[model samples]
Target: MRRRISMLAGVAALGLTLAACGGGGETPAEDSNAQDASGNVGVFTWWADGSEKAGLDALVKVFGTDYPDVTFDNLAVAGGAGSQAKSVLAAQLKAGNPPDSFQAHAGAELQDYIDADQLEDLSSFYTDNDLTAQFPADLVDRLTVDGKIYSVPSNIHRANVVWANVEVLKKAGIDPEKPAEDLEGWFADMDKIKATGTIPLAVAGSWTQVQLFENILLASLGAEGYNGLWDGSTDWKGAEVTDAIKAYEKALSYTNTDRDSLSDWAPATQLVQDGAAAYNVMGDWAEAKFAQDGDKPGVDYVYFPTPGTEGVFDFLADSFTLPKGAPNPAGAKAWLTTIGSAEGQAAFNKVKGSIPANTTAKTDDFSEYQKSAIADFGQDTIVSSLAHGAAVPVAWLNDLSTAVSKFGGDKDIDTLQSSLGDIGEKFAK
Candidate 1:
């Protein structure tokens, strides 16, 4: 999947953290003076908002109750997308005084930490706590490397969803319940939205917006063709891949923003919420914004899997890795274990509006559309992550972003297809 932005339209994006599941560990050296009867844990994350902070604080409250002696230093390092936090983490890890635990996404993101040998081995932690039986084998495997577990996934989020305003669809005389079934159907619906004077697709043409392009291509090409282009399994020059790129080019033309200077995702989010734009391609977490605005799913807003890949769920799971030389290694390992626990996942994601990574976590409070996502999680046909971020190297994905932005501006299918082919051919090596 692509990099996750805050799902709440007006709110800043929130990052994740790590904690252990079962119990106290011997306090590490950095926290030697900080330890008491309770395990002292230092956590670093990027969540900044009253509600988001409250939600996280609720997790802290739970942790405190379970481990009363545990002390916590909530470090708020603010910057968009953890740009500052990552830098601080690198320094701390190098200095051997890192936070007890920190955040990173699941999948390839964990590879770097594993290769650096900074993270504690959690194979024993997972087995002792029975986490292996709790989380899905695929998810466990994605977090595990070379027989060592370095991180614990916090939650699973579906990325390939189109959030549409129900009233806008109704105004366009389109059925809110049953969306267009295929790519042509998607265009027909968007055409109706445009005809109704609604921006067909709300978008910002920034690098991150390229994830939507990948989502659209995934729909057109299906998993095999899309993954092939990224993982060296398929030739990007093949007609099928070209056709997928062409489909994305056609969709790009329907975007609401001007090509010169695009709006940011927050404003694009507002455009859809305010009904100025009919739809926004975003992750399921964005539902939190709609809920905050007092909108009900299927009534005020409707979420549909991107057209043409209705049953194929594309997902991203959030995880936290212990940076090398973490200040509180034992506490960090404890945090990772906590993140993988069903209770902690459910508690954290409930406020965050994401599905718990542990399959056993109850999802009774999720909204109608979110419940649908929980159902999809049970099905084995889902792809773990989309190609834009975790599944492929960041360098290749950046190239794809450039190609997408070019397509968004030129609206030329041939040019876009050639660019994708060129990039794909190189990455396939």
Candidate 2:
């Protein structure tokens, strides 16, 4: 489970062997060489550490077995949630020096790449690989643009989970088994935890703040209202939105005061694992981290959908796309094939704390939390996750993140609401 994938690029000498075996020794066109097909496939992602990196390593293993000739050049840039990698990737794509394939969110966030003509049409890749019938139809639809699929989703993650340390909750005289039924109930429990001198909630800076705000929005506005936020229907200044903002403000009060100093979501989750905090609202990936640290799911830590979000799935997918003009087009396609395959997905999600996007993947090896996630994904009302870059364009998400960061410092609800209104108007147009 803690295996590290070797990121070494196979020696360039192997490309010569491949070329020599193909026919008479007439050198092939640079773009038509086998190296371009199955040589070093530059696999790009932000999975620089933790279970996320382990999962990528797992997938890389699968790719190596499937195509022994191809070398995996792991181009991972370390930053929480692709914050640093995305900027690097954008520059690469803009300069036409694209990686063979790169990780991306599977919804509207991909529209920018599609708009910029940086991605290859992957519709035929789906059909050729028989993936059209293997992946969820709705997921396929979300990944499609202009009647063509562009990315292959590796796994699905739920964004509305709250991870709590059972011991911390018990110390606070709160029942760990019975999580709050609503936002008000959550506040009441937070009060009790506060009295016990534990950090009532643990939150990290930047994107994690947006993740919390979005879940709070889901809890306050319900699934329908939450969906309306991405579309043109939800009024950002409405009373429901106001209520959500108020709830977010109150919830912020219970968070660790040192939250601003925490750079990543894992540290916030660590607070819960170390029993310094009662709750950490985050994606299910935290479960994988806990498991890696030898914590049992129900005993050491427990999870529930963030309060008031019981029947909803704030969902996002980690996907990979074939960038146009890739150096190793063949290797890229092979990598995508493995990503969309049942065996590959099963291997990846088992370590990554997500459910396979491929429905045929067996869940027998998944953890208890992952099993519950599979069930929830099957029945819950699905909505795009704003924090994970599924619900809006990249620019809009950046703007929203900036607004949330400012709100964190200023606590100005009116200004925050106005900014959201402007973002909505700009994106809607």
Candidate 3:
């Protein structure tokens, strides 16, 4: 019960921005007429390739349909969770050339921008569009800071899904219908699959690897302990943290020998889809990749919460924020309107393989995988995603990513543990 309260407190903390921080430069005072707003609205994001692009295309189609005069500028820079793109975005924001609206994860990740005062309060925007009523109350709380909302979330994604190839599992004499109840059984199955002369697990570097670490932490430490890591309640140098790191090391062993060669997460998902690997633990967005290739769920593949996270929803969201000096405040507002609309949410999330942030968004036409995700999200113990910027701020995640990636290369559990402690000291203040 103590841990549960701590977890919720950490999540609630996302809604409170740094009070000490000041505002960004001069901004437009008037919001453009969303309906009558006619011009190019440059919405920048990190989804430039593969299935991610397809999801963006679906959203763009909706934007075009609703706002005919507003041209959607696809200013996407490809990187895992906007890794490479963020530095570029920072430069633009610093130079006062920020995009009209930009993609940001919907949790502590928004704190940096808010602290810099680069983001505009969307509270008015929400009231204007009835978005406050449309979005889940809990989600709205996370998106709000002080009394102001800074972004419009497009969709909620589960970060703890394991996508497996059905035929590959069958070939290894494993039942695709049954999900491994715990890591012991899951690793045993991976061992069996490894004996079949294939990569038992598929993974990529940087943020993807960090994501894998967080999932392992969730499995080894449970939701409370996992959430405790961010709040200093979980001892970074303790035996449990050590054990989770070792487990992460063991899991990395089953991954592809050429993981470094696999630059982006989709390629890792592709490995599973192509039957080169048996499983890929990734966000539900991987479902979008499989869907793009005409792969049917439960036939070509299957999804389950990452082993040991059966009833937990590892949550993250992709949202667009209106920058303070956005060249087109009207156009930014228009794009945000589409983002908050039930029709727009349905269109975007359907092709995106995620549940809409808007609770009232229709789901009758969604795929089986999406429906399952929606149901799980509705009933599960919700935890924030570290890799996707829900659990930690960007600086902390970036430093931790470095530690995790180096450990992936060196296999030094001690160094990794020490690095974690150093990071916790530096950031968990």
Candidate 4:
């Protein structure tokens, strides 16, 4: 996904003044005429290229059918982890001139906007549109705060996938169609891949890499130890978490790749695409990269959950949120509605490599990997990805990332566990 969301104001003081005044007020206000008024939807996002962009573009295109006059102004900001875009968005909202719509995660992450009263009460709109009928209860529950719907999800994404280069696996004397079921088997396969002169694992220190680390942690520790770290119900200093940390350190030893020097998600993905690396830990959306490279899933590449992890499902969802005070309230709402509509969700996820948030949407557009993802959703053991920064509180997530990175960089398991214990205490407070 491209990081293309940025602030659209302040290029010129006079220009901003005129734009605000043009709204027929001294300061910009919501388009009350929306629904009853012609509303423009100003969307802020980070999807600047590739299949991710295609998904959002499809949503915008369909939105035009129902709202022609509602001009869709997209502010594309480019920054990994959306850090730069988020900083700009914070400034705009703080200055009382937020975008009509912006993207937000479908978990506790939205609490920041809700705390600032910078989000609208979407309860009525959700009811009016009957969105509950299509969205899963868990998804709707995640986006709801108190009693109001603060956002509308476009799709669900699964973290914790092991993407392999089928050709590379064959060269390594491993079956591309069948993956190892446990950590020992996984390591053995990696050794075979390494013996073949291919990078056994394509990894980096980037946020996405950290996400992959967390997925592995969950697989190594199981859901009990995994959820305990963030839910305030389990101890991070336990044998399970320690074992997970040790496994991560051992895995990092195998990350000897040209990608070790880079910090982007695409390089690791490209390694798999180019068949330079035997495996990569990424989300199912990686299927898009494989498809883009003309590689066929199950033939050129295959997906499996991190080896040996039970309850082998990780859940996360993405959505667009309308800022509380928007210049294009109507357009934003229309876009949100379009996002939830079965057609829009299907169209977006088909290209983006994610499952539609609307459960009613067809999965035909998804590739073989995504088909398995949808099947996984049916299992009762699915859990959220704390490493991808979902489900857990932001503070705990950052802390966990720091601790995990240290562990990956050769920190002792004992020290890593101690750090986790300290972070867990802070989260509890």
For each candidate, give its TM-score against the true structure.
0.83, 0.92, 0.93, 0.88
Model 2: residues >4 Å from true position, as ranges? 1-36
Give me the displacement of residue 80 in model 4, in angstroms.
4.5
Worst 10 residues of 2 by lDDT: 7-16
- Sorting all predicted structures by TM-score, with the top scorer first, yields 3, 2, 4, 1
| Candidate 1 residue lDDT tens string, 225-299 | 665665667776677767777777667778865633553345566678898888888776577667766777777
Model 1 bad stretches (over 4 Å):
1-40, 49-55, 75-97, 205-207, 258-264, 410-429
Write the residue-wise lDDT of candidate 3 on 108-216 in tens digits.
8778777887777778888989887887777777676787888888998899999999999999999999979988899999999999998999998788999899999
Q: Give all candidates' CA lDDT scores.
A: 0.64, 0.80, 0.82, 0.68
lDDT score of residue 322 within candidate 4? 65
- Note the residue pairs that clash in candidate 3: 32-330
| lDDT per residue (tens digit) for residues 204-298 in model 2 | 99989999999999999998898788777889978889889989999999999999899899999999999999999999888789988999877
User: Distance (Å) between predicted and true CA of 327, model 1?
Assistant: 0.9
Stretches > 4 Å off in candidate 4: 1-39, 80-83, 257-260, 408-410
| Backbone clash count for every predicted candidate, in the order shown | 15, 0, 1, 11
User: 1 or 2: which has the higher TM-score?
Assistant: 2
User: Which sections of candidate 3 miss by over 4 Å?
Assistant: 1-31
Cα-based lDDT at residue 317, candidate 2: 78
Displacement of residue 154 (Cα, Å) in model 3 is 0.2
Which residue window of length 10 is worst by lDDT in model 1?
4-13
Best by lDDT: 3
